[model samples]
Target: MRHFRISFLVTFILMAVSGWWGYSHGGMPGLINALWITGVLGVMEVSLSFDNAVVNASVLRHWNEFWQKLFLTVGILVAVFGMRLLFPLVIVSVATGLGLVDVWTMATTTPDVYAKHLTDNHAQVAAFGGAFLLLVFLNFLFDDEKELHWLGWAEEKVNALGTESLAVLITMGAVAACVAMGPVEEKYSVLASGIVGIAVYIGVNWISGLLEEGEPDLQDDEEEGAAPAKNGNGDLVKTVARGSIGGFLYLEVLDASFSFDGVIGAFAITNDVVIIMLGLAIGAMFVRSMTVFLVHKGTLDEFVYLEHGAHYAIGILALIMLASVKYHIPEWFTGLSGVAFILVSLWSSLRYRKRHAAQA
Candidate 1:
């Protein structure tokens, strides 16, 4: 409860603002509808992002407090404003060659057309997000160092064959297949976007490795004669940043991939970009709060395989989004499937613990 206090306050304040904005645009009816819609959207985002919270906690628990604060503060801001607001607008701007102001006006005044404009590029967006997510999943699966095998033989084999080149080859093959099957007009865009996604992942990973390598380990830092690293803030913020840089970007990209589906799906419920932004932002805030809660309460350690489940769910999502380029999968399907994976993994974790205890 204490962990969620900030999220609750932010949600209330944003909901009120959304209501006021609705009233200003329409009237009493609009106000009521706005509140209802916002609540629904917020809940929807949270449901779709529950696994995201677990994965985030898995990464966050390894970070220092300073980095965690940075995630809660700067990360949330980026999640809310960066992905929620600017990303869609940027897409619209790029597609239509319209200025930001024009895009905003179109989205607000001519919502149907704005949605069309956005949805029209769904293939490229799906391809990019899907490719990135697929790579993430593959990388996790290919982790030969991972000793825990949820599926026993299958996972062990996959991990054994897992290498960077193999993951890239598989991802490229998936993207190529999509491009080959896609419409002639959209094929180039889809292919290019997917390649860009792959490139971005590689670039970020490389940079993270470099940053991490530059920092000394915790044991080395504790040496009496060692001088601590300094940054613009005159502290070990740099060290923490370097150490967790990979995780920071990974989480951000993961959020963006999730946002690709969410931002587009919001149109099904409402055309008002403002309403969608407010609602999704609230949900994102709560998810972040949940991540913190999971970390502070040691939920991940207790659950054991929760992180595995989340990653597996993420893999399904990546495949679904890739499949969605041609077929239209409902948002409900994505959300429910993720929840199912998480719940099953949780049940498995509990059962495993019981069995192990009995054996002991």
Candidate 2:
């Protein structure tokens, strides 16, 4: 109870301070929308990211208290500011003639134009994001540890590049060329980008395996009181092997991935870049903090199927991304689906506890 209280108060203080700062810098309308936008987006993000904490908990069990704190403080910065702050601006600036600062101004001042631009590109954005997420969701269907033999045909095609660096560079060139040819076709860009994302995932996994196989094992540190660290040829595998970063990184990566859609989507909601940033930043921060709380408190362990629920939420988000490109789904539906999932996961946990208590 004491730990829970401390975590809750700490989160409240941080949110309050950030909210006040955003309001002061932005105008009253900006402030008002920021509050509403932040509330809605925050709840949505946190609910969707519950699986992130569950995965983080599994990996975090290896870390000492210091690393845990680092994961909270530094990791949050990486997730919030790096992903939510910098990435969207980078995407918009590169995609559109607008700089992030200008986008911010437009979001606050000339929201309609900003929105129009985003709407213009929504389909391409949706296709790219939708396809990428589709691959991600499909990955869980296969045995994650399986080698790429099943994808042998794809492997041969990808390997024809001779080197991973070349493959990535070639992919980038292709995307750039498509963007440059004016009147960017939504179908083409979406398909290419989607395939590229899947290729990158597979390529990286393959490369990591080869590298790990060549390494020598590290001496066990009895002091650590954790599993033996994997040392390859005296090089410590400092990170988890084979997609082991857990739901946190998945959520973080997907959150950033989702940002392209979100920032693009936000333009439609309101142009006030200040409102967009404040709303989204607050939302991102809250989600990150919520992930931390879930990990620290063992909420997922308490709720056995919560992780599965979050994955389902991701699937929904992916579908929304694809659907938004063409048809309009009510925002209420997007927001409510996530909320409902979280509530159900929570209910499952409570029920489990009650049943266990009665049996005991």
> What's the lDDT for candidate 2?
0.56
**Error of model 1, residue 169, in angstroms:** 0.8
State candidate 1's TM-score: 0.96
Q: Rate the local accuracy (lDDT) of all candidates.
A: 0.90, 0.56
The alpha-carbon lDDT assigned to residue 137 of candidate 1 equals: 83
| Candidate 1 runs further than 4 Å off | 227-234
Candidate 1 local lDDT, residue 84: 89
Candidate 1 per-residue lDDT, tens place, 1-360, comes to 999999999999999999999899889999999999999999999999999999899888988788888899999999999998889999999999999999999999999999999999999999999899889889988987777878889899889978988998999999998898788999999999999989988988897887777765656667766675555664565656554777798899889999869989899999999999999999999999999999999988788888889988988998888888899999999999999989988998899899999999
lDDT of 1: 0.90
